[model samples]
Target: MTAAVPTVSDAEAAVILARCDELARHSSLTDGIERTYLSAEHAAVNYRVAGWMTAAGLTTWQDAAGNQCARLSGSTRGLPALMLGSHLDTVRAAGRYDGILGVLVAIAVAGRIAASGRPLPFALEIAAFGDEEGTRFGTTLLGSRAVAGTWLESWWDLRDAGGVSLREAFLAFGLDPAKVGDAARAPQELLGYLEAHIEQGPVLEEEGRALGVVTGIAGARRFLLTVTGSAGHSGTPWPRRRDALAGAAEGITTIERIARAEGLTATVGHLRVFPDAVNVIPGKVEFSLDLRAPDDADRDRGWTLIESALTDICGTRGLDLASTQVHEAAAVACSPRLRAAIATGIRSTEPTTAPADAARPDEGGSDSGPEAPADDAPRELPSIAGHDAMAIAAITDVGMLFVRCAGGISHHPDESVTAADVALAVDALEAAVRALAADYPAL
Candidate 1:
């Protein structure tokens, strides 16, 4: 009868590294980080994360899609919460723990569950979001797609790169772009979402472990394409040149050989071209793409073999393709009872032993009982970038917990992590919120 070691102190790992160096001193690059979305360093990191969510006792606020919320209460008062969070916006020379160390490790695991007075049956919010690195409106999960009600009134005519617009940066950040649909909420006011973040890749330091268990989140698409043709005089003669950046460099190497024959994850990042004369020849071009998979029918079958190899590489170079699909999303998964409570919070962070094919049979359900998932098995993975839990997994049961960063190097400033792997990611997200309140209790 000994299972109970989820710790995390050291003054809660120096109050989550001094609140991630006090939100990287409200950035916008005084020579480093940037912090975007409704700017002014996103309102001084949401007024210092609502004063560290009211000194961690919680009950804060700031939502209407600018996110930064808080709360607490459980075992009573209007339950249904268990949210936790991430995203505090950043991206230009960013990385003081991408998305502020998952909202300061969910307010240091809700201040270690309100100093263990133990009552949790649900309520525990948190958030912090403010636009997951859309970096001032490129449109990534704008504050988790307005709390998953999926906001998109044409993304208020998205613009910024200085052209302004996301409704004049929400009325110059004072907010009220028609109350951003009051930041939608409703999946019965939630009782799922988790988060934690920072594995930014290298699979928990190549499985030497420090938490892991996302198995879902990659379902992107993006596109743009373009191509066109007929410009000339790069000594125009090669059959009257129809270049369009050489048919968009052979359609970006056949979109990297059909996303490397379906193991998926394409990219291209960006391009452009037009007639920028290096003696001309190119006519248009454009580019972009992106892709990504881990399902959604293999990211719509690799965008149908990258739109049939960019329509046979722009119809044998007479070039004229167009495209568009600016973004898609979809795949999310993670709830076989929260991937068995994030694989029982990465086996409560250590002490291992069972793996001769670790008791099979329970497929993805992982036999959700005593927080089941340890016979040395839990290392899920997936997430090929993009989060705000893919727009709060369209309103509920999300789950994630990564951790190990160092060489996965996320969005710049040498993206690191360690304070003993964020005190084992706040004791594996407080043992995945007490293994989902012992597998969903309190009716």
Candidate 2:
């Protein structure tokens, strides 16, 4: 059996929380946190966090993509690393813990591991990804994607709100655009990737648990939908009017209905109508559709049905229907190897709250969990929100731990987590890393 994982002290927990507040100060928004890619805010946080990593006993450096990274050599001369981390960027007006908590927790965990002086078979590394939220450039996971060797050449042309192209921003940030590829890591360089993030949902809190296991991430697709019709007088006869807005309203409602019935997550978040004159009937409408599902086949099927419904809605309204696909990502499941290790970590720590009875094999976790967890097993669920792990999945096996966030709130200033939970999470994360290290004995 694996040795019992150590629990973190409250003082350690307090330090992690304090660093989050300090990180918030680097934001551009005085009222709320808003750190973007390649901004001064980004550089500030990288420099600050790199200092913390060094104090934690790791060799620190910034990658070509501007991500903050640190490493501790293994007992052997060379070996692929057991990686840990999460992104540091936040959405505009974001809550404090969304991505911030994960990085801080990783640092604290690294500190504990380094202080122990335990020998490991694999090196340990931490990655504080720079641009997971994508608030500035309108593209998510830019930092992790670049590191995964999936960076698209066309992204250089992508511009921020200030009209600064990504290539130009790279120069301003003092990163060589041509050398960005140097950040990419081959599969052999990393044994696996692990991330700890706020639940960003109420599942664990609602269940009175401080942490949970993430089974997989939802697959997502986004589209720009347009409906076109002829302009007409406001008094036009009902049968003669090809009202694009009316059709769009129906389409939005239909999307919600289908999403509900098909078990998908769909939203018509943005909508615009042309010909805004009070007297003239609107002739064109444009809307954004964000569709997601537990898996690729489910998402694709729901999209097909929604598309067919929109076609029929427009056909009946005498309007034309068109759609442009903008973004797509396949569902990614946690690696069984890493999942078991995380489960071990969680099991080794006592639950913050009592569970009704000893948790059986089926009480929590994915159906494929290797074994039953402890008496108060961590709740298991899927993540609907995207993460840097999704991008990293392209290069190596991935796993994630979700700490409870108050009220399931994220992307707002009200996001919150408890010190007790943070301490538990820190312990769980460190234990997981230790478990992975034990798997490969020192050379």
Candidate 3:
């Protein structure tokens, strides 16, 4: 049997919040956070995280892929590790706690376990992945991909907004580009991975819960769609004009309609129209399509429906349609054993003040306060956003814990999490570690 999980004191919660604030100060933006991979800010954050890792009683190192990693031994020397951590990178103008909280929570878990002085069957490892957002190079999960042994040779040529290649950035950051392959780990070397992250959506908050267990990460497919027609004077008669912009407008509306009807999330975030002048008819229109679903087959079906609709619309408008898929990432399902462990952890950390269930209309519901449900059934939801765990899933089983974020907002400066929630998350994470040790004593 495993030992009792440690209680997360107020002091520990304060330290985690303080560390998050400190990391926020190292961002490229003065007004907001923007720490990209391999940038100067990236190096600074890694150095500080390494110091924290050592303080937590773990040996530290910066892996070849630029991830700051630390590990604590278990019952024996050189045992396969159970990895716990999240990405340390952020999007442009990002919030302070999205990925940072997960890494700090992992460190706290390790520290608490180390303080107990109880040996385990597998090693406890923390990996602060360097690049999960891919904001700098337009390719996500670079750090996790390397560790998963799925690094692609084409990534070296990818360029940043400043025209710097990934290879060049690695050299400038003092990482040997040629040694990047060394970051890869065989599946046999790891037991599994666990990440605790903010929900980045309104589900938990809406449900009046502080925590939830992730069911899976959504699979995503991105496409570049273009509509072509002949440009003409604005004065041209409508019957003679083949307006691509009009068709694009119709296409966008149809995309939203199809997504809503199909129960998927589809976004057309970027759009460009040629001859952008107000007095000229647009000859061409281009837009980006990002579609995500909880399952691969579902997502593919939605895409097919979307494509068919767009094609028909464009044809009706006498416009030519073209599309190319730029990126695709498969969905990742969490490990069932780890999922149960997390659920158990949530129950262990349940606050006495939890209010009534929000699902029941008779229950008085308020978005501002936590609602304790009548049952111990922790809500399980799939992550609509991408994460490092999705990449690491290529190598080992993975699980995630979702903490409620204020307003379900992320990737923005306003992103926020309550101190009470953080405290609860730490408690849950510590319990999860203990539960894992008990269930998988043989590693």
Best by TM-score: 3
| Residue pair clashes in candidate 2 | none
What is the C-alpha local distance difference test score of candidate 3? 0.89
Query: The CA-based lDDT of model 1 is what?
Result: 0.79
How many clashes in each structure?
0, 0, 3
Work out the TM-score per prediction: 0.36, 0.91, 0.92
Q: Which residue runs of candidate 1 sit more than 4 Å off their true CA positions?
A: 1-57, 63-65, 71-83, 87-125, 133-136, 139-167, 172-228, 231-238, 241-246, 258-264, 268-283, 291-374, 380-382, 388-428, 432-443
Check candidate 3 and list the clashing pairs. Answer: 354-372, 355-371, 355-372
For candidate 2, write residues 47-120 as lDDT tens digits.
99999999999999999999999998888757788888898999889987888899999989888888898856
Candidate 1 vs candidate 3, lDDT winner: 3
- The candidate scoring highest on lDDT is 3
Candidate 3 lDDT tens digits, 85-105: 899999998988989999999
Model 2 error, position 334 (Å): 0.5
By summed lDDT, the worst window of 10 consecutive residues in model 2 runs over: 360-369
Off by over 4 Å in 2: 1-8, 277-279, 351-374, 441-443
Candidate lDDT scores, in order, read: 0.79, 0.86, 0.89
Q: Cα deviation of 169 in candidate 3 (Å)?
A: 1.5
